[model samples]
Target: MASASRDEFHLIVPNESQSAEVKLGSDVTIPCHLSPEISAVDMEIRWFKETDCACLYKKKEVIEGRSYQGRTGLSTEELNKGNVSLNLREFKESDMGVYLCQVISEDRTEEIIIEVEERKDSDGQPVNQSSKIQGRQVHLILHESNRTWGENQRMKMEESALMTEFEVNYVKVLHQTIFKVFKNQGKKLEQTELQLKESKTDLERVLQQLETITEKFGLLENKKDLDMKEPQMQQIEKQLLQITKYTEEKQNQLEEKDTQLENMSKQISEKEKLLESTIKEMETSKQQLEALRQEQMRQQELLEKKEQLRISELNEKSKYLEETKSLLEEREGKIKSLEKEKDRLNEELQDKDKRLKDINAKLIQTVREVEKKQNQLQGKHTQLENMHKMLSEKMRRPENKELEASQPDEQETKSKLEK
Candidate 1:
């Protein structure tokens, strides 16, 4: 039973009322097509009259029961397209029972019950089932003749609207299997209300018919009191009772449909509120995305500016080192030349020591001046070396990676300058 209910969710069948009225000995096709149709050629289809199996079809061949051997059959081609409309050639009294259509697809089984009734009327014609119990989400039978009423145009509009509702539902299911009711809930609520109004009208008409039938029953009772035919009177009473029961059931079903519509309206309101909430959340997410983009742009600009400034500082430091290095070399060369001249003068003055004592003091003064010049040159070279070392250390800092890459070349240049 649990499996059957689950299968109904997957397998949509057009079930009106459980019972179908047909003329005695008439060929009746009970429509049982699967909605959102799929191929059912491999499924095991069986029609059982209570406990006795009427017909059964496996994969290849169809086996008929002794009770309805020639009478029961299913279309092989229709089975391939998920349609298993059972054909009862001669619907007899024995065939009028609660027959179940048990279909085995893969592993799960689904069964739907429908009754085949023989209508006993004056003309033996089948009574119209729609006029009696059309409120049940009874999809018109597959390829059934279109029933035209006195209000042809109005009836067509109602049918078209109802069919549109069904199609819309099918489409929604196709699009989204979950949260499906949230979509077009408003539109569907309106359609349900329209159907509800129509059902009310139908209920009123059935009420009037019931009242007229009650009057007829009273008349029949009066005739019996006056010595009317027993058999005829009893038959009429039976028909009237059946009609009254059917009408009462129909009225109840119509009322149920009204309740269903009201429930739908309430659901639509809830869904509408939910939709509004979701839209607000979407707007919030959009705003957050925009803020993140702006932050990324701002950080990128800051990085670029910092990079440009570092490049400028690296160029200036490199140029300053080059200039300082040349100046150190030039001063060292001049000091060395002055020292060589003073040393030669000192040697000459010593050779003429006895004769030029007065000139010796002037030579001593020149030697002192040359010594001072050499000492100043040595100090400048030491200071320049210290500055160069400090500059190289600063270049090796992590943030100056690009500048540090050229540190080897700068070191080689310093070595050459020292040489």
Candidate 2:
């Protein structure tokens, strides 16, 4: 059965409701809770990356492991308070994956996943070079990269070739189409003008006929002076009266036709106005279409520029990668050489250490000998002092006896001489 320590703690991460997506370089906090009261203060905290399933932090220190050595950071203060959130600085696209925070307690172990995302630059550009969009403002900077500039130049040449071909084809087709349409419109306008002129001529002829009838009526009225018999005169007068009536009726009919002609003329004028307006509208539409085409051409040019920039950037990156690989290989070789030198130095150090130990032992032995010699010298000095004292005492005693004898002798001689 699993130990209770393995089931006492739980790890929690932010859900979708809490955050939609977390961007790179942004601080993130993960929450963990211990159930049944955590008592094992010695429990170890570990953070593992899911991409490689490698430990990033362990035992309150960053692991000297492969890729996470310099890239991972964590807050010790937060960890003490059961906050084992890890902060990755300068977040990379590779960091955009799941991470696991593991806590090993006496009774339980818990883990949680954290997702990292690529950060965007101030201009809303992705940090990953592959995901960056080419901007007009960045063109000059991108062109500075030799590879990108070269690719851009090549692409420009290719696009110029293609555009030239397309322009030739498009212009030829457009010219033909426009010429045909203009010719047809011109023919239609000419036909309408001819019809209008014919209508006007017919109207003029009708007016002339009405005028002639009026002249005839005037002649009949004037002829009233030349009379014959009453019946004959009455018949001529009736005929003249009929002729006048017919001329009046004809005049009314001509007036109606003139009105009709005027209406037709007005309609034609209105149609001409409409046609002019339509032609203006068509001109406007053509202008707009031309503008749109020009804009599209500009956009294509921009796209080509972007592609060139991308190709150049890729080449530069490849070169940089190559250089980095070479540097890394050199560093690896240096590290191996240093390792060997370190081993050699360690051996030399061990030999020096042994020599030093021997030297220290000899020094200690010499010190003991000097101490013994000092003690012997102290004992000999004490003995010599005692012997000299004895000798002094003996010499003083003999001298005193000799002086007393001399004095006694001198005194006896003086006594004898006095007697």
Candidate 3:
């Protein structure tokens, strides 16, 4: 159902309108991205070669369709920006075919098709293209097929990069916000502590003043007893009353300062608890990021192995191509020899035809000469029959004997003229 929905965004192939051509035994990336360029970090990217699923990215990890494995990948950094291109590490003969890229989101799913074609031969023709050898069709095989193996290394790289990026950014922002809160609270607490210290100093000064005043009042009492005067006694009593009232007020001020100190301590304790929780959360995030980094490193090692395997494969392929080249050269020589043989056979047929034409012409001339002789014989036979008829007529009429001799001479002359 999501596949059919095209509500707000749609996937598109940006490079070409119809298809893309990638060389055999080479790398290629089929570009597909979103129309409005929204983040695709949370979306699923799936690639298929015709009906077979070549790669699947769902639930933030790869699963099933290990067909392409190490040689294929998608860019996580790009995926975050909605570019879900499929990369092919090494293209093979079987790799040249139609491929589909599917992107599924929470609200919509879209797919696009790309046709990857094998690179043409050095002669600008496909290696599978039929060739003519001695006027017969011959299909040539020119390249060697070699492949590498591993888990989907490309996907691993992208996943490690993108996933880690998101986590790091999240943790950093959280750290900054918490630090700001702590800084403000700390400033407030420091100010309160300073005020409490000032209040303690003021209370100590008040106690010292009260002790000095009491000592002076005792001296006045001794002086009043010795002088025994009314004015002196009244002055001492008024001074005592003022001193008592001032001391009581100082005591109340000290109690208020004590209350303020206690409250400040409680507030500091609450902030400390919050700071501890935030630090623990940051540590947890660090642990997760570290795990992803380790996974990325492992994937990197696999990639190195894949590269080594590819190098060995390339060497084998080079050797295979050399062997194929030698075979083609041998076939070329054979084809050339067969062409020479065909030419020789054609020349012989031409000569035989010419001789047959000459023989037929001579036979026709001889038949014409024989036909001329047969015509002469037929005229002589007619003349002889006419002569016999004249002789019989002469016998019937003895008186016409001289006329018959003349008729016989006429027949003989007529026969000679016919000849």
Candidate 4:
């Protein structure tokens, strides 16, 4: 036989129904400890009002409500010693409750209730109001002469009115607090009533069990009845023996079925392993195919870009070729016109050369004629000089003067007439 084992976790509260009282505005500590006095450093401790389940402390942290904020604490030192007690500061009448100190360890949970009561003052009046008034310290002072005494009196009256207003508000707060306490009490009472009902039912069941036990003991005391039931007891024993055999047979069948199931499970695991390997292979192949597709798409895009570039280059070349053809045609037409102009100029140059040659021959002929005229004028000037010299020689002869004189008159007359 296999014995079940579990962690031994337990809590010990000195008094399960511990009750403590403190005056209003006073601090109080509710105690709880571990059963084995073991470290509860890792345990969760919850301090909540059992009535309303309002949590006040939890797991090294305080879940402070509106009235509990800055007023609840758990000492770390005590927690290490397994003391999951809660220290409540500034108690109020509304804080009165059956608070639960729950210690939750690894495998076990334990809880205890701590009844905290609100202690009253010496006059049997609630101490909450006394503390509130003392803490407020409401004071009014006046410094005025008799002339302003009337005004001071009015101010004093106003101060009294303000105090009364504050008092009324405080009364309202007290009433509300009382109402909340009653409401919590009513809830707690309802829970207690339910618990009582459950207890009554359990007690009735226990009483019925006691009655059945007593009737069985009375039947066992009669020897005559036991003797009369001997055959029936034997028959019951035989039937029990048959049931035991049947149960043994069923157990054997179940064992066989369990063995078969184990074998089938092993086979299923092997199939699952093979399937996983196949799936991994398929995933790798899919990844490779995806990569190939991506590469193909990239190549297709490159080809498209190259084709577009080539088309653009071809268009540019065609445009350049067309321009070059047009320029060649224009150059050919200019060459033909230049060739014709050159032929016409060559003919004009030949005709001008012939005209200059004719002018040169005419000038040479005119120069020869001028030279002949100059020679004829020189001969005429020399003949005139010879005739003057002959006349002078004849005038110098004296012997022949008479004959020359008579001729001289005629010569002189002739010479004078000639001169």
Tens digits of per-residue lDDT for model 2 on 98-195?
45565776556665555544445788765445433322111111000111223433343333333333433454565566567556655755665565
Candidate whose lDDT is highest: 3
Across 297-338, the per-residue lDDT of candidate 3 in tens digits comes to 889889998998998899899889999999999999999998
For candidate 3, which ten residues in a row score worst on lDDT? 137-146
TM-score (C-alpha) between model 3 and the true structure? 0.29
True-vs-predicted CA distance for residue 258, candidate 4, Å: 8.9
* Models, CA RMSD each: 35.8, 31.6, 26.9, 32.5
Q: Once all C-alphas are superposed, what RMSD does model 1 give against the true structure?
A: 35.8
Estimated TM-score per prediction?
Answer: 0.29, 0.27, 0.29, 0.27
How many clashes (backbone atoms < 3 Å, residues ≥3 apart in a chain or on different chains) does model 4 have?
0
What is candidate 4's lDDT per residue for 1-419, written digit by digit as tens?
Answer: 11222145455556544434344567766666766566666776666553222333334544543225577767778766667777777755555556656676666777665555544568965445544431222111111111222343334333333333343354456557656755765575566556556555655665565457447645478877667766755665665566566556555655655665566566656755765675567557646755775687679789999999999999999999999999998998888888888878877777777777777777677667666756755654464455456556656667577456647555654664355
Alpha-carbon RMSD, candidate 2: 31.6
In lDDT terms, how accurate is model 2?
0.55
Shift in Å, residue 328, candidate 4: 3.5
Q: Which has the better lDDT: candidate 1, or candidate 4?
A: 1
Query: Would you list the C-alpha lDDT of every candidate in the order shown?
Result: 0.60, 0.55, 0.63, 0.57
